[model samples]
Target chain A: MIQRRHALTVRVTHWINAVALILLLMSGLQIFNAHPSLYWGPSSYTGAGPIFELAGGFPSWLTIPGTQWLAMGRRWHFFFAWILVINGLAYLIFSIATHHVTRDLAPTRSDWRSIGRSIADHLRLRHPQGEAATRYNVLQKLSYIAVIFVLLPLMVLTGWSMSPRLDSVWPGWVDIFGGRQSARTLHFVIAWLLVLFFFIHVFEVIVTGFWNNLRSMITGRYRIEHEQR
Target chain B: MASGGVLLSACDAASRNPHVTKVLSIGEFLSQHVQHAVTSRTALAQEFTEADLSPEFRSNGTDYPDSAEYRALAMNGFVDWRLRVDGLVERPVELSLDQLRAMRSRTQITRHDCVEGWSAIGKWTGTPLSEVLALVHPLADARYVMFYSADPMDDWGTRYYESIDMEDAYHPQTILAYALNDATLPIPNGAPLRLRLERQLGYKMAKYLMHIELVDSFARIHGGKGGYWEDEGYEWYAGI
Candidate 1:
């Protein structure tokens, strides 16, 4: 039987987030192409070797402008960044107020105990079926929690730390991240982690009935299959 | 159809790329408004300690002015060089390095964040730009403080220049730095003088400073955008 799964707010925020994240990632790559290097301390320059450096610019297809245009890249990045931040804030506040976090995303004691078994099942490509598929599994809940609470906040903080204007108001942010360059390095590394998560997330959706899963997200109606025990 | 006509009329080829200009304008507007709303106009950029200074503050942009006139001044230790402060001022003044040094000076260690994703901390000593502005007394209508550098940015002899809003120009941290790292400013790092606008990106801090112009608008300046980089599509407000 099919029932309402995602709320309207969730569905709307999800799509907005999808668009914003894609734009952010693409424009961010374009911005990265300007320097293509990351450092650990307060300073980095010609003589000072960077902790990480890309050999060359990303391909045109990968960037926002599809060209080596730094100013344009920055425009796209900042534009979408505001959208991402606002949408994320609204989603976070709404989710917490609605008890979405407590009801679905929070890990229970038994869920914690089942984490090892869940990991093994995931490794073996053993996915939830029938009624089990109706609700999010323990691993899904934990990943969502980590991404929503930890990674997203880190990204926002690191982004803020890079802004000279923001730094003037809150100087300690730069120190907390070790330095501006360190904060930048962390921002890049965490972005890749999110990218990895996105890929895995998509793969999981494809494996577990792509249309049904995607349709549920879009239309807020999910069909729960009944299995004969 | 009416909206389309208006959109078509608004589009200009030289000013922006039609494909991305809409989003760019929105972003610029949002950034300006949000930053101004959230941050105090007089907020001081983060200052570092002597211990926090980088062993080597790598200089970005033009290290030395290539002009023969500038070279002649450099050879004589810039003693002949005079920074002209003119335009929209009650009293125009030409200040030598010695005269600038003689005035009330301030020293602070601050981090320089470049647009190219690098940062360096260095100690700077110089006369507060506010004092210089006071000496000249900028006109009430002067909205921007334009800085002219001796360095030629292109083959056309167009000098590198930058400008800041009157509020930023009067900020306590804004100064014309003459000494770096407890010594005379090096040639490779804007010798004689440079503008230290710590609240903005490195590019906004014009080096090899030669002239300071108080202007009501930047529309008549080179490229009419208020900066060498800003003329070439970089944001005029480099607060980020």
Candidate 2:
């Protein structure tokens, strides 16, 4: 039962992705305050809600005196977006060039059945691995593949739907996505999925064995416990 | 990571070589152009609550004009500033701030999106662009209206300038903003005159009013595109 661990490159990429995503989400929330409601909702509403208010709904700290809430949000959002983009691109390019994305994360054809079995084992509906599979035990490969290929790419495309270009060059895209307003709504929903993914990934790591996983990622090695048959 | 992906795709979409694409390709232009109304109807959206506005909207590009002409106008409180509404118009009027203020007004609370991927909602008060256009009476040849501002970019030795098409020119929310938050537009915020085209991003809203030229096409205009960013890598039709 020789156990392998995350490589240094994978460890760095994971942490970079984690930090960039957090900043992007926080700043993105500020940007969304401009038009709060999901576009598909009642047309009666457009641009509602407080981006930031005092504890008592009072203005006591660093108030600009006579500025609008949306304006301030714009400043923060624009500045933070630069950080998120540069950081994210670095990690993405590095992962691809290093073959981490293609090699370790992507799922194979057999992963279809193994993923279901792995889920059963994780939930304790079945015993741990039968000492048969090498590398990722199906569930890891499936989740990683889904995140890298499906969710992240969807997030990028839906985000671009907000651009004015969506109307001019690709009215077809707008039609396919229902409409521009609907695309904005989808972007918000997908962002929530990313937020959920972050928490669950972290919580699962802790539950499985926090110190072990953390150290393996950081140091790139883990002790193997071999049970002699 | 998600937001990063968003920025990447957006830049990819915005990518273009300014030289070859003299004007934003209609197909590429419309891809991002905010399709306000299929018909050529111009109207203003609803006004916004004071609470809905952002606290600090940072100024981008040139904050103040350096040209002697603009400096003199600003020094005189822009009372003498004349926004020449000429070219392809029936009246070819030269309007004063006082005259503009006297006209029928349209107030709208709309989101101001920036190319940098940030947005803000603010209440803008001004005459509907169409109202001003009516006085000019665009000629049958006029297919685009170019906005020339006093904000100088001083490219090498020449000055910087920008323009827009008729579609954006007549958007319901498009206005020659003179007031912000119910006060005289501040200098830093393009006082005396600035555009508030709600659908397009902030860069398209050229500040420091000077002239509005009605044109048949953008071919002869500076760079032959629309906006300064369009002369660079940005898509001229930045509708969001």
Candidate 3:
């Protein structure tokens, strides 16, 4: 019996990050009073554009109906942003110091094949390949890599696009996103994508064997059937 | 539903996309409810210490409205122009710039987050909107207030108007502003008169304001959507 791995710091960080992302998303939606329209295809909402008024001090009565809640939403968002940033930095520092990031998150050659097989198996498109699965399956590695590298960085960059100072400090970032308005739109769309990713991830876990997958994340060890090998 | 009542057909278009529209409507409703509960007809938009204030607060939309009449008012120190308050009020009144200046005022330092994804912080000073509304004596049926501007915005030619429910109207921080950063309102900043509905997105604070009308509802307004952007599918209530 390969003993189950004990709870590790990365697991804690991952769960914390997941929770923080949820809060960030909910608060962000509340603040997204600028353009509330959603389109199905190529047609878009014009209110998606930008309107620059440096320091807002308008009578609430002058506003349309939904903006008042956004006021409180913005306050929570600012405070929560600081928490997320600090938490992320701390996770990064700890991961680097412990070499956990390189050892665990880095993909091996065999991982690509196994991950692909796992995806096929999960979709019921292929039979499970016989192999002695180690700590994490192939799908887990890919998801982890994408979340850490692609989604996390995109979120941070897009979030910063809203800063007026960003244009002065990192003109390149604003330019990369086309313009501030485009960046804002991208930020919101990406946020929605992440939310979609989160739901799918949770659903997959439940479908695959909720207790088995969940326990591994919590206790750091999952059982594999001897016959599968 | 009545013929002369606020026309609500545009709202029928808005209702077609209900999920988005519902969220937008809820925001507007909440602002009104909160504004009504607050004392002094104003609520402080969030406040900030000196450290939070940005070095520059970029102006948006029209820094200075291009209308010739408004330019004349600006050139002459805005002494002649008056802010009119009528519509659903029992006592219609007009206030000169000086009289508005003499009223009690508040100064706040807050952040302005633009829809275009940029933000800045600045200090603003203005008379509470509650004080001005009080002068007109809003009737009991007046559930919403409308703001009309002299500036023509985009294709929404001639008038720039916005309406909010009474609750937000009474927020303590809600103001009919005449100053920015301790100076008289700049021409580009809706000088001589502008509204600062703190707690909303930037566009809600329409500048170069001309009239305030009290109404039972917003359905009869142009496009029947409460604001220029609202007419064009932007969320009617841009709170935060």
Best by TM-score: 1
Instruction: Kindly list the interface RMSD, in angstroms, of each predicted candidate in the order they appear.
Output: 5.9, 12.6, 14.4
- If ranked by TM-score, best first, what sequence of candidates would result? 1, 2, 3
Predicted structure 3, TM vs. truth: 0.53
Which residue pairs in candidate 1 have backbone atoms (N, alpha carbon, C) closer than 3 angstroms, thus clashing?
Answer: none
Write down the worst ten-residue block by lDDT for model 1 chain B.
B6-15
- Taking chain A of candidate 1, what TM-score results? 0.96
Candidate 2 Cα misplacement greater than 4 A, ranges: A1-117, A120-161, A164-229, B1-30, B33-47, B155-157
Per-residue C-alpha lDDT of model 2 across residues A136-208, encoded as one tens digit per residue: 6577667777777777777666665565433334333544554444566677777888878778778767776
lDDT for residue B202 in candidate 2, whole number 0-100: 78
What is every candidate's C-alpha DockQ against the true complex, given to 2 decimals? Answer: 0.32, 0.07, 0.04
Give the best candidate by DockQ: 1
Better by lDDT, candidate 3 or 1: 1
In order, what lDDT does every prediction score? 0.85, 0.62, 0.65
In model 1, which runs have C-alpha deviations exceeding 4 angstroms? A45-48, B1-16
B33-139: candidate 2 lDDT, tens digit per residue? 22443322343333345655666555666778778888888889999998999998889999999999999887766556565444455667898788999888898
Residue B239 local lDDT, model 3? 45
Separate clash counts for every candidate: 0, 25, 36
Model 3: per-residue Cα lDDT over A1-229, one tens digit each: 4346434776686677776676567557655544453322111222232333323433332222224454444434544565666677888888789876677667678877577567777688343322334445666667767877787787777666554323324323455765444566677777877877788788877776678668777888776555632
Candidate 1, residues A1-229: lDDT per residue as tens digits?
A: 9978888888999899877777788778888898898988665642557888888967656676666778777877887888888899899888999998898889888889999999999888888887778778999998888888988889888987888888888665687988788899999999888888899999988888899999999999898877868
